[model samples]
Target: MAQVANLFDIIHLNKKLADKHIAAEVHLRDACGRQTLWFELKDVEEDTLSRAQDVAISYFAGKGKPIEFDIAKGINFWIKQF
Candidate 1:
């Protein structure tokens, strides 16, 4: 499927419109069996909300979710968590 984004839509999205955009994105990802695992987002470095990801990392880390990144084995079959 084609991912479409345009400047006008991005610049004009209010709270309601932004929520619709997020819901649509979630529906599309769910339809394709894609999930947003926390491991994949713990390295976010965006300018505005980078600290938000840090907060999640600290929270999950306190709960002991793979609190390390020492993966050495290559994925022979499929991609698993680090």
Candidate 2:
């Protein structure tokens, strides 16, 4: 079974990215000390959220990392594996 080693919330982000959109990076660590990166998009309209989710899901799925996201609140995240 897979296991999560760490969950990193985005406490800081690039100013350019933030100014462009509600986007940030979230990092995850796995049992073997491997790190995976994911993107977070907050306070988005429905259409934008949908597009972002689709792109994120596809990208992260290729990297073999599952995503945990909460749109209502700020981008606080957790890590889990199967």
lDDT for each of the candidates?
Answer: 0.27, 0.45
Overall local distance difference test of candidate 1 = 0.27
The C-alpha TM-scores of every prediction are 0.28, 0.37
Each candidate structure's count of clashing pairs: 0, 0
What CA RMSD would you report for each candidate?
13.2, 7.1
The ten-residue window of minimal lDDT in model 1 covers 22-31
lDDT of 1 by residue, 1-82 (tens): 3223233322432222234332211111122432222222222344312232233335334444422222442111111244
- Candidate 2 local accuracy as lDDT? 0.45
Best candidate per TM-score, number? 2
Local accuracy of candidate 2 as per-residue lDDT tens digits, 1-82: 5533232222332333454463544444333444344445554565544554444455445556666665564233333465
Worst 10 residues of 2 by lDDT: 5-14
TM-score of 1: 0.28
CA shift of 34, model 1, Å: 6.6
**Runs in model 1 lying further than 4 Å from the true structure:** 1-34, 37-46, 66-82
